[model samples]
Target: MAIKVLVVDDEAAAIDVLKYYIDMTPTLSLLATFTDSRQAIQYCMLHDVDLLLCDIEMPLMNGLEVAEKQLGKTAVIFTTAHTNYAVKAFELNIVDYLVKPISYERFLQAISKYKEQFPTSVDDHFFVKTGTKGHLERINIADIIHVEGARNYVTIYHGTTQTITLLNLKDLEQRLPARDFLRIQKSSIVAIKHISGTKGGSVLLTNGNLVVIGPTYKEQVAKVINSKLIN
Candidate 1:
């Protein structure tokens, strides 16, 4: 089932842009859109909205109040032009914050957070923003060989393809199943199933790759590897 989405923004142009983005995403179903914050709150009374993409500043009522009304019931992602509201928005424990005008790539990143909140199936896969704007690529957990991070990006190597996503390595590690993936270093994580063996201080992957174990993570990695050893 597609994630039921509701869009609320005072500006018609902003609503239209969100509508276009919602249409392009394969897994999202736009339930309705509202220009008035009050009307949006009313619409939620009669419908089941999985995700709410709402603006912070509105005419009659601001988006923060709108979120307060739907708290606990609907997962929210704030779309606003202001940078000051970030601290307060996260206090509500919403999915993500999108600073407008939000690009399609950034929209995808927000959707990725929504997906994390409500997983489709057994948490088997997740979407990542690809090189192209307005495009998202789904990556399966079981297919991943190893992931390495540099700067603000992480490269996911799976099957024969490598996809670079704008995400911190630590953030990505949190999403991956702990049992399925091993954090061998600060900069890289190897799929436990794809790990062939450890060669000296390095972890060897099935596809002929060696990831040097970070000193900070060595003890934890050693403990995991030692547990699997057949004495």
Candidate 2:
């Protein structure tokens, strides 16, 4: 599935360059471009946008305003000439924030986050081999409940079923990518898509699986929740 992207920047040159990089990536497709940040927010409300590339300072509205309005449907990556917005951008938990004048290399790095967020599933079901007869697994990315570490082994929980793989939790974490999967504890990483909400000591996944939150990972989890990725 091609990623539908919206570009919002006040500068014509910056928009052109950013669009160029987006076009270069075969997985991404440009949905629209807006010089006015206010119009960008309207576009977001009307359209199904997968990713957003927006500038911080604009005429009618700022990038953060645009991001706050659009964050529910689209993953944002801020493009700005100023360095001051970086901390705020991180606080927003944007996929990737780039300082202008942006290079194609840097642009590519940022867009890679989009790919990670919306990976193309091979089939409705796939296989993860662990050298013992190589079992066929019928897995959909959206159906994933929760993942937990049992010592050196990682357990994949989906629906009412569970599968244990020889891979460690960290190794599984690397494979899943941080853009969609967030580490809630050293032993657990919950899929952002699967998260319903957080309450008390529990992280509630959409599939109704409740995972415990670790004290060490509370700050990072707070950042994720406060950023409004999940309700």
Candidate 3:
């Protein structure tokens, strides 16, 4: 299903720009356009809108107020001329904030933020070519444990078997889902679910293997720990 979008801006130009962007994006579908915040809120409550591109300052209802009403029902991306509203708008757990006149590039950036927070399409499995002529193997994404890579080859470890492919770690890393995988070091990447524990500078996998975490990645590792474990 397409990600249903609703444009709620008092300005006709803003609404037109957003509508055009929504139409250009392959996954987005505009449900409706509203110059009135009240109507937008009412329609969203009665329907399903994946994202609400709303303006902050309006006659009856501001975007902040509109976001409050749509709290759990819909995700919001605020459009405003004032930078002052940025702090308050984020308090409502909105997807992104856009200051008009919103460039197409900036608009796409906000859409990317929405996509990352709410991933719509995730692959169940991916294919890799083997050394044999025209032989491709399907690797289940969930079964992945860890990956070890060298300059010329990448080795994937899943359950009890390992597969070596011609792709490097940098190339293979992009194929896996970011939410479920992490590049722990220069030469290795580990599946987040397969991590049993962490030592000083290493990750312990459930399969009884330890992978060293690179120095450059220690900050990201610390952040994950603070958000998911320590906090």
Candidate 4:
């Protein structure tokens, strides 16, 4: 399936460039374009947007406000001429930050990053390098319950066993299918299928282990829960 994309910018020219890029890329589909940030936010709230490309400096509502409003609903990539907001943008866990007059090459790179974080499909299994000799270990995605990040490495918990891999949590999060996994904390990513319930600020896995949801991620966890709640 093509990745659904939404472009938001006050400048007509910027929108045109983004549209052109989206058209040139076969993996992406343009869902909508917006010159007004508020209108864009409304559309996003009503649609299933996979990726969002927005400009930082706008007349009525800035891109930061839009991102804050639509947080956790979609992955965001900020495009602007200024470098002042780069730090803040990363803090929001934005996919990428592009300067104005974005080159086709750089734009493609950003899309690649998005693809890494939100894979198109989930595989039945994946391989991990193990031990000092770098032996390969095959792991079924279904067997994974949760992943805990410890500084430079992540411990992957499976059925009765755990595998420690020298990979950062954010990078590991990108490798897993977004639909099957949820990043509840800076150091934790859990398989959605294994999440039995949520208690207060923590997620209870089927294995009976509790993962504390970070304050920054609580809103996102709540949204996920609301979506799954049967009315």
Q: All candidates' lDDT scores?
A: 0.86, 0.76, 0.83, 0.85
| C-alpha TM-score for every candidate | 0.54, 0.52, 0.53, 0.53
| Candidate 3: tens digits of C-alpha lDDT, residues 1-231 | 357899998999888888877654445678899999999988987897899999998999888999999888898999888899988999999999999888766887898898889877766788888898899988898999999998889899988888888886655665676667777777888888898889888999999899998996787666555667852
- What clash pairs does model 2 have? none
Candidate 2 residues 52-141, lDDT tens each? 999999877899888877666679999999999888877877898888888765886887776777666533334555446856555565
- Candidate 1 stretches with Cα past 4 Å from truth are 122-231
Candidate 4 runs further than 4 Å off: 122-231
Report the number of clashing residue pairs per model.
Answer: 0, 0, 0, 1
Span of ten consecutive residues with least summed lDDT in model 4: 170-179
Better of 1 and 2 by lDDT: 1
Q: What are the clashing pairs of model 3? A: none
Tens digit of lDDT per residue, candidate 4, span 54-133?
99999899999988987888899999998999999999999999998898769978998998898666457777878758
Give all candidate RMSDs, comma-separated: 12.6, 13.3, 10.5, 14.3
Residue 107 displacement in candidate 4 (angstroms): 0.4
